[model samples]
Target: MRLNTQIQGQGFPIICLHGHPGSSQCMSVFTHHLSQQYLTLAPDLRGYGKSYTRQRFEMKEHLQDLETFFKEFNIDECLILGWSLGGILALELALKFPEKVKGLILIASAARPRGNHPPISIFDYVYTGLAGLINWIFPSWRWNIETLGKRSLFRYLIQQHTKITYHYLAQDAVPAFLQTSGFATDALNQALRLGYNRLENLSQIHCPCLVLAGECDRHITAISSQETSDNLPNSQFYYYSNTAHLFPWEIPQTVLNDIDYWLTQHPEIFQSN
Candidate 1:
């Protein structure tokens, strides 16, 4: 699939997946801490970042690709950390291949396809659509990180580490975000048509689960996280104070600590199946 990936640290394999328009680099905050205890593999999902895409995007195909990636590393069982849209993929993976999943960690994930969400508002929809068109005309408009609601610290780090210019907004960032959002929407709609839903499949997941949500996130409310926890037979939930949808980026240490503690309490789960 020619996915752009970065592998660091050395221990049990931990696959980190980013959300829409977000590359693996989005999770770089946790690389140092996670690498300290486990091998970390973060990949830019196809159609985002440097990954190659053929035609249409398909969740099942992407899942299959990930399964192959795991097999290549001899990772029979490992932790899966997915954020936002990546969280959806994480749950799908666990559902489709429970034996390969050791533990599941979801950050700011939706329990099901949402309706009447803030981002779906008419203003945001029109604004984002216009912003996308503007980006198309002015590819260098992405440098304005302020519009992205990024904290100063995050903005500084991204500017210092990557060449993410304003143009990236129009050329890659914004479009990717919109595209993936649409992809998720379509997938969710199809699931509904097929009489399947996230809540409906939650009982099928037997793996230990850790669900984290941002206290201030309007996109995926804390209610979703709580419901996910309630649905999973073996799950624990935490809500980060003063955080938004970007909880992992905002508090990687806290998240890592929780994961470490959880794994410590469930060492038996990590053993080969």
Candidate 2:
């Protein structure tokens, strides 16, 4: 299973993983910024983007596909940068294959599984359902933007419901998200069918970690973010003020700068446990 991947730069390899409703394309700009200091390899995870051709979506298969991706690329060990769901995968990789991970950078990630995630209130559900319907009806990013243009409901969804409020959604996120081809639906179902959540396994991961949190994020509560950092054996947690889930896209330079500072402060070369 050859996942569609994008690679750039030439230093220490940094595997980039996007969040749910995310794709490598959505991550392209972010990785490009990181490419100045590290070799960035961003791939669309299975059941997402270009890899949605599989018959079914399974958490185990996603892990296996990544393990295969590493071997196929001859990546013995490398740093990892993951967002949200991908962050969970990164932590899992570090726990399961300690030698294969140098360091970790997780953004807007939750330690607990989706069940622990905050549920959308009934009022916000209206916006979420509407957004879902729009996504279902118009897979085209341009069409979605034009369709939802300057509408109060769109604003409600962006600012209150999802808090993505991303200008790039029309150009980057929505386009890459559309490429998921409705695979997230199946994947969401698999989450319940498989009953997978590694909240109890945090201590197993020993790699140095950098956890970035958004102060204003509603998707993941501040207390949960703090608890996630507290659980990690080695982690530096930073919360950006006035930021939300789309903080990386909203302020790439600030996010990149913080990441650079964190990486520089850590061991220049990791001697894995």
Candidate 3:
């Protein structure tokens, strides 16, 4: 399938992958800045945004789709930067195709199930439990048919998933949420069940890897990210204060600068080995 992608600038290629249940639009905050410095391409994963659709997808499928996506775009190798679920895929890619991946930049990513974001609101408490039950009792396809396809209803649900107050949401986040919502709920359900841990193989990853997170990130706590860094054979970890899960969006300039410095330190990574 021809995944719809947004490409800008013209330099070393850097592909940005968004989180589960999110489309490439969510990466716009970072892509907008990175595009000026690198040849950036952001695509809506299958079943989300303008990409091909399916009833469900697991982590492996996402990785495979991305492999094909790179080939179609004539990208043999380049930097792989992923946020949240996207970061998991980036790790898998590096493991599976070490020769094709030059380096990795993982943001708000972990190797195991994420702990609950703290200060859980009363709404999140109830909603989280409800979502868990829904995943267990129902198939992802059924939920996508019944609820995921409805844009308006999905938007409301998006607001509830965040730990942040809505005081700034409608103005700060909802627009992208609305545009990025047409994804299969099954993909997200599979992710929650993914428990996508590659602890044993973390040391197997030899490519230069950088993992970043927000100290205040509720989605995937900084503690887990630190562990991921600790296991990596060649890696570095950094966290920002008062930040949350959405690092690329929450602190675009910092992410941009950090990535730039890391890449600069290893100019050889620019070559696909």
Candidate 3 ranges beyond 4 A from true positions: 52-54, 118-176, 179-183
* Global lDDT of model 2: 0.71
Using TM-score as the measure, name the better of candidate 1 and candidate 2: 2
TM-score ranking from best to worst? Answer: 2, 3, 1
Candidate 2 matches the true fold with a TM-score of 0.80
TM-scores for all predictions? 0.73, 0.80, 0.77
All candidates: CA RMSD (Å): 6.2, 4.7, 8.7
- lDDT score, candidate 3, position 160: 32
Give lDDT: candidate 3, residue 129. 44
Backbone clash count for every predicted candidate, in the order shown: 6, 0, 0
Best prediction by lDDT: 2
lDDT per residue, candidate 3, 1-273, as tens digits? 567888988888888887765777767767877788789999887776777564555546677788889789888778888888788888888888887778899988987746664354566545544443443344233453244322222222222333222212333344334444344556667667755678888888898989998776667888889899999988999988766675555456677899888988988887645
Model 1, total clashes: 6
Q: Which lDDT value does model 2 have at 205?
A: 78
Worst 10 residues of 1 by lDDT: 154-163
lDDT, residue 104, candidate 2: 89
lDDT of 3: 0.69
lDDT of each: 0.68, 0.71, 0.69
